[model samples]
Target: MTTSTPAPTEAGLDLVTRLNAYLEDVAATLGIRGESCSVDLTGPVAARMRLNWRLPGFPERDVDLMWHEEHGWSAAVATHSGDGHHVVVAYLGGRTVASQPRLVARFADSLRAGEHQDCWPGPPMLRTAGGPSALAKELAAWA
Candidate 1:
């Protein structure tokens, strides 16, 4: 299986830009109080991509900002991938949920639209329920 690393490229940055704009709009729609939603500056990608590609019922987390009193994050989004940026949502004092509905929809849209690269972990790595892969382990880690 391919590691979750993406190649750094201008195209990847493009995806990140779209994510920033799209998230801004979503935050406005729900009147996201405060700057709860934002693009992470320290993220590996220059910007975050917002594509409607993801499973249903997942919530979006502003990965841009992670807060940990113990760890004390001093920046936004901390994932290191060439895919541009990962949606950063730091609820509950700076923990992240990988399977947020809003985030999934955005990612799924990008995948379906062919705008972003296919970053699925692939086969044994692709997350699924009882599909004989790391899906169970990954999901369990989240729980």
Candidate 2:
């Protein structure tokens, strides 16, 4: 038997849609060809979602993106091997370069080129945080 996940709220859906569109544009700008790429709404109240993309001759990749009205945005890329992960988070004073399409494009380019050294190409402010649950809680309250 399978359990169904509830649909996200309209507000949640809208934010995810916007983020997805930004990434899609970034991919296009970088000339990263993919037969199909899409975003999944993972946690609406948490303002969480994920993007999956697969370029020709390569395995797919997943990137978790989240947002908080006060904190801005954050991104997490989980290694396919399930052994490691990378995170890009908001900076001091609640500033974030993570939402910039060009930066995300560079990250995708680095991954595609196999030049990702210990999650290089990340923002200078990048660091590991307590994880999504905290952000999710914060977003839930705001929602």
By TM-score, the best candidate is 2
Each model's TM-score? 0.24, 0.38
Misplaced by over 4 Å in model 1 are 1-8, 40-143
lDDT of 2 by residue, 19-104 (tens): 44554554566554322343334433223434455432344555544433344444555566876454542222133423455665
Residue range 19-135, candidate 1, lDDT tens digits: 444445444443443245434333332223332223232333223322221222222233455454543322211232233335544543443344434333221212222321222
Alpha carbon lDDT of residue 20, candidate 2? 47
Each prediction's Cα lDDT score?
0.33, 0.42
Task: State residue 76's C-alpha deviation in candidate 2, in Å.
Answer: 11
C-alpha lDDT (0 to 100) for residue 24 of candidate 2: 55
Per-residue lDDT for 142 in model 2?
24
